[model samples]
Target: MQIRPFELERYFARHEFSAKYLLGSSDPEAMSIADLLAFEPGSEEELKRVWLGYTESLGDPALRRDIAGLYESVAPEEILVFTGAEEPIFAFMHAVLEPGDHLVVHFPGYQSHYSVAQSRGIEVSHWHGNPNRNWAPDLVELPELIRSKTRAILICTPHNPTGYLFDRSSWQQVIEIARERDLYLFCDEVYRGTEHDPADQLPHLADHYEKGISLNCLSKNCGLAGLRTGWIATKDRDIYNRLATFKDYLTICNCAPGEYLAGIAVRNMPQIFEQQRVRLVSNLNLLAEFFARHTDLFSWQRPRAGTVTFPRYLGGSALEFCDWLVAETGIMLIPGTFFDMPGEYLRFGYGRASFADALARLDAYLAG
Candidate 1:
């Protein structure tokens, strides 16, 4: 089936390699393979020996087990690996949705969440997150969007761009809605582990909803985007089987080396999260100061978790500002319009150690 272009990905493709300061990236500062390998006692030799053969189609059992350990209730048997979070989302929408099925999707979201479904002729309704509420979706709007044909509720927590984390109560309310509506709950939890406080991490959706499908990856939180390893955890046996069957036509199996490195990353998640948390907290404070200094030209609601935040530009259109900033100072920032958001806002990722440097350059650019 054909699909519309993924606008954000398309924009990245053209500028990502050429850009100087990548303030638009979603992943935190990435860790080297050597750093990740150091987590295990005997990893040096094992990493050197990781073969080039095709890995298990269902993913290496040990790797799946390591991923399962992240959730309290899921087992390794229920996890199915994919190339990346993007793959599972595309596969899932194709595997589960039909032409007339209605889907409730979070708006101002990652483009693929709705675009792929829309391509299949699925009826999609947006559940909007108001900017006045720090980009949090009103659960009140959910039921009104649901129709008899509604089949799924899609969400992103520790959400992309906005970094809004749902409290446990919000999670429970959404699960209750899905349960009552008989709709599948597809929660993209790729950023779940990056909560500002470890204690604030919410339960995996698969554990809380019978038909929930939780998608995760080593990209954002683990800072192992190069691994391209992601998975889906679901309690529904039927969906699990269907996804597996559908997988055969796509990537028959994951890359063997990436699997090994990702296994190492997953096993040392505690250290990774700790390092990333410290960086995010520090950078976010710097971002706060930056925005405060330019309050008249820009406005932002500090995010609760994750690597990025979308801020409104009072000076000019986001696209115009981003283009001028990049051309003048070699600092790259994403215009919110790339995510189908209004042109006044832009996404800024401040999880990198270079965030201060980027901010300084932006300051100079804006002053000139």
Candidate 2:
């Protein structure tokens, strides 16, 4: 299948390692394998003992059980593991959606949410969020975006870049809309556990709606991107089976050691989430101060959750500014152009422990 170039991933490939400071990454600070195994006293030996043979395509049973516990009503049998969140998305695009089918997606989102489908000749409509309203999409516009061919509504909560977490009421409205149209709901919940306020967290869409497919990964919330573990949770057995079958064409099974490590991470999520939350909150405070100081150069709104925030650059073109900033100071920030967004917006990430240091460098650059 022909697909458009993945602008964001390609950009990261070029600079993610060489850049001195990454102010646009979405994952929280990662922990070492030793630190992860420390969560359970005997896990290190267990990890060492992990069989290097092929793992179950449905994922390690224990890992599925642990993932099941994250949802309120989903079972381990309903979970289909993938190499990462990207594979499941690709699976859904090929396995479920058809050429004539239509999809409605949250705007300024991860490109794959719509790109793969677009490549397959599916129609896509963006449900754009209002930046003036702290990036919240108007619920009223949602119903109107649906058409008879619309097969699904895709969204991200504790969203990437903008950090827009839906209030429970708005969250329900989205599910209800999908329910009314008998359309599937796909939620990119990779950032689910990183809410700035725990109360603001919404229920896993799969638990609340029968047609919902909730996608999650260890990369974002657990800061375990290297593990490359992600899964889909859905109550619908048919959908689960379809995704599982499609997996045969992809990474048939996940990495054996990665699954073992993922199991350890999932079993110990409470502490892991707490660790990320503490760091996120601390970095957010520093970001607020930095933004306050640079009001002349940026239009900012503190996001409710997630690792990154999109702010408007008062400087000429966001792309130009980011290019100049990175070249001059070795600090990397993503321009909104990468998200298919126009105007002067740029994504700023505050998930890393080095965020303060990065912000300091940007501040110093501005001063000089």
TM-score of every model?
0.98, 0.98
- Residue-level lDDT of model 2, residues 156-225, one tens digit each, is 9988779999999999999999998999999999999899887788899999999999999999998999
Worst 10 residues of 1 by lDDT: 10-19
Q: State residue 97's C-alpha deviation in candidate 2, in Å.
A: 0.3
Model 2 superposed RMSD (Cα): 0.9
RMSD for each of the candidates: 1.1, 0.9
Q: Pick by lDDT: which candidate is best?
A: 2
Backbone clashes counted, model 1 = 0
**Candidate 2 residue 40 C-alpha distance from true site, Å:** 0.6
Off by over 4 Å in 1: none
Candidate with best TM-score = 2
Query: Candidate 2 — what's its lDDT?
Result: 0.92
Off by over 4 Å in 2: 16-18
